[model samples]
Target: MKKPLIDMKNIRKTYANGSLEVEVLKGISLTIDQGEFVSIIGSSGSGKSTLMNIIGCLDTCSLGEYLLDSKDINSYTEKELAIVRNEKIGFIFQKFNLLAKLNCYENVELPLIYRCMETQERRERVLKSLEMVGLSDRLKHRPSEMSGGQQQRVAIARALACAPPLILADEPTGNLDSKSSNEIMNILIDLNRKGVTLVLITHDNDIAELAHRIIRISDGEITSSIDCKRGM
Candidate 1:
């Protein structure tokens, strides 16, 4: 049997504001396998973002066991975690998060630059990723020069350039029009079909329905998880 790609056990996160204490996660446990497309849906302040952060390795749980690819991530040092984040996972945000000054190709190549990849290899990977998103012709355009949908595509291309096994997207389609949203979702679906595991965080039911499985959260706990074979 193929082991689960992500195994999270009894995870917990808490924050304090003076005398007030907020518990964001109440012992959450989840397991996601390779090639799976999952959506995490929840209301505001329901800990969905916190969970996303933990899953993306951007933050650690106050208590719990998190294993990525069968290796315990809790034991990794900050530097090690940085490497894991860079090489194993890709992230997309609601705001597109592209550098304003850099052109499409340069923005996509940023990750490779951080990893100190050779210039030629970086260029090849960037171009391939851009091509995958059908944005090869827009490589020279800056963020301000593109529409919201185009900017998001560039962000997706940036995420893909590293060839990470896992992609964590937070409200990826929130800023786009219905047509653009569908386009981005189709891109994500195609990527998953090609064997990239994806975990999407969103409040929109329509967007969540695109995944093969859905996990609903409320009050910092998983309320239910349903398998939607229809692939909405």
Candidate 2:
């Protein structure tokens, strides 16, 4: 049998603000299969973002186990976690995190450059990723020259350039117009159909409906997990 893509058991996260200890995640557990499309929905401060950070290898749990691609997350050092992040996960943030000065192609090619990919291969990957996002024609345009939607597309292309197995999108449509939001969601749906496991983090119910499974969280705990794909 194929192994699960993500496994978290009894996960907990806490923050220390001076003498106060704040428990953010309270024994959360979840499993995501390869090729699955799952959404984590929560209001602000529901620990949804905290969960996303752990799953993306950007943060470690204070307690419990997290196995990503069958490797123990606790075993990876900070440097190893950085490598794991680049190799296994693609992240899309609410804010289009593209640098203002870099052109679309340059932004998309950044990860490849960090990986030390050859010039020719980097060019091909960047072109292909931009094409996937329908921004091939905007390759030379800087982020400042593009609309919010266009800038977000560039961000998506940057995420795709590395071809990571899991795509973690945190409110990818938060800053877009309705038309642009739909376009972005459609692109994400297409990516899911093409076999990239997706985990979307959103507070919008309509947006969460797009996923096959919707896991709702409140007060740092899972309130509900609905499988929407059951009849489909």
Candidate 3:
């Protein structure tokens, strides 16, 4: 059988300041298969955000093993971790972290530039990703020139530009209104259907319910996990 896309075991995260130590993730063991849509749901002050950071390779776990794509991520050096982040995981943020000065196409092409892809290849990828997000016509427009939903779509395109196997979204709809949030969620659903493994962090149960599986966390521990019908 093929290995699971994500295989985390007893993952822990702790922060220390002076004489105080706070444990954020207390032994999280979860596995997600390729092409699955999983949502991590938690309230403010919970460890979902920290967990997302760990999964996205932006942070390391304090203890236990994390296997992303069957490789031990905790064993990697800082530079290797950075490379893993760029090559294996795609990130979408709540704030739509786009460059205000760059156009949509440019923003989408930034990852390819890091890979040193050829100009023609980057152009093809950028245009294809934007088209997937339904932003083909807005390629030349800047983030400041678009609405919140459009900006989020551009962010999605940027994430897709790398064609990573795993997509990690942290409160991707937090800054959007209801209509915009649904639109963004629909786009994510479409991507998952197309074989991208999706992991989303959200505080809203309604939003979490949209995913095929929901993992609930509370007080730095996994409280429950449920499989949904995925009415997509």
lDDT order of candidates, top first: 1, 2, 3
Comparing 2 and 3 on lDDT, the stronger one: 2
The Cα local distance difference test for each model comes to: 0.94, 0.92, 0.92
Clashing pairs in 3: none
How many residue pairs of model 2 clash at the backbone?
0
Question: How do the residues 31-53 of candidate 1 rate in per-residue lDDT, one tens digit apiece?
Answer: 99998999999999889999999
**TM-score of model 2 vs. true structure:** 0.97
Backbone clash count, each prediction separately: 0, 0, 0
* Cand. 2 Cα-lDDT: 0.92
**Model 1: worst 10 consecutive residues (lDDT sum):** 223-232
Q: Which residue segments of model 2 deviate by more than 4 Å?
A: none
- Give per-residue CA lDDT, model 2, range 98-211, as digits (tens): 998899999999999999999999999999999999998998999989999999999889999999999999999999999999999999999998989999998778888888
lDDT of 1 at 113: 99
